[model samples]
Target: MSTRFSGKVAVVTGAAQGILRGVALGIAQEGGQVLLVDRAEFIHEVAAELPQGRGTGFIADLETYAGAHAAMARAMQLHGRIDLLINGVGGAIRMRPFAEFEAAQIDAEIRRSLMPTLYGCHAVLPHMLQQGRGTIVNVSSNATRGIRRVPYSAAKGGVNALTTALAMEYGEQGIRVVATAPGGTQAPPRRVPRNAEGDSAQEQAWMQEAVQQVTGSNFFKRYGTLEEQIAPILFIASDEASYITGAVLPVAGGDNG
Candidate 1:
């Protein structure tokens, strides 16, 4: 690991588990002073498990304006500067054909996958602007070009768009905005699954079909590991990729997003 981020403050949303957990740990290992934000209290536990003085945690629902703002405010309060903002606050809430999705489910997907990035970027721009420098890496998905989860795909597409527009708008102010569209990524079984229950025979088939669609869409025809997905994101956030902005780096093994 490189101490490229030594003394920098990084804020990563969805820091409770899964990809975000791996991202938070990697950031700390690279010498960033990380602030883990998630809706779950377990975020605090993650912070506690970090090396002494390496991390802190904040529990907030980042999908909302108020929650996003509060998280940013707290980061500014603790570290006085937020050099990196990783908007990892998203996932497939449910997988179903577009027509099969209820109105509420579509709304839920957008809120889960879109609102956080939108709100997070909006909330943090003021601080980054005032400091005249920052880097943001929003998590997106290759599902934008696949099937069965139209709403989630649309939401991630929105993230890509957000990344491009923000980087263009703020490039003059010394802020770099980028996104990573990760493909199927292998990781530990979720500490909390995305859904309450979906293991029925039909649901299994639907879910499996979604998997097939995703796997086939990628040239590599396999999932990536947590570390594999985190590397590019960390690179894009670090000073090493200082000249790269307004770009979406796909970590989907050739599944162009």
Candidate 2:
């Protein structure tokens, strides 16, 4: 791999497993010092797996501003500067029709899928502003235009808007904000699943419907692999794509959501 991130300090949220873990590993492989953040204690395990001294772990509930601020503060204290932040702190907690969702469930979905990215960006902006150069890549989903998960879709839509607006406002300050709207991705079983409760038969059927719609919307009619989703995000975060900002690249076959 290329040392695009050589001499950089990167903060990756949701880094306990899945795409965030992959991103963190890739960053370290490319010579970036990485701080892995997640609410799970296993985040430390993931950090330990990286090359010695290349990775460190921070456990934080990024859904809250306080947690987000603390993670960024710790990164600054350790590295003295942060060059990149990959906000991967979201996933759909439940998948069902809009009407099937209770008010509290809808609120929960939004909180699960939106608050982290929102707060992460806000918390990191001051540091990036001080440095006068940084890149942020927010992970989004093509489900914004597909399926039964209306609340998750809305939340990712907010991420897209946040990416664009932040880039516009901070481009002059040397901060680049971008996002990747990935299709369904195939990865190892989650070390921590988003929802612990088992799905009922009806819930399974509703989720299947959402899955079918997502696969059908993409030209390949299949989910992407973790690496497929990781490349665009890393590219966007890299200096190679230095001129690119305020854009959401879709990594969903032909589905541009």
The lowest-lDDT stretch of 10 consecutive residues in candidate 1 is 195-204
Off by over 4 Å in 2: none
- Candidate 2 lDDT at 205 equals 93
Model 2 is weakest, by summed lDDT over 10 consecutive residues, at 190-199
TM-scores vs. true structure, each candidate: 0.97, 0.98
lDDT of 2 by residue, 1-257 (tens): 69999999999999998888999999999999999999999999999989889999999999899999999999999999999999998999888889889999899889989999999999999999999999999998887897778999999999999999999999999999999999999999888877788778998898899888888888999999999988888888899999999999999999988
Can you give the lDDT of residue 157 in candidate 1?
A: 94
lDDT of 1: 0.90
In model 1, state the lDDT of residue 144. Answer: 89
Question: TM-score of predicted model 1?
Answer: 0.97
- Mind giving the per-residue lDDT tens digits that candidate 1 earns over 44-155? 9999877789999998998799999999999999999999999998998787779888899999999999999999999999999999999999999988888778999999
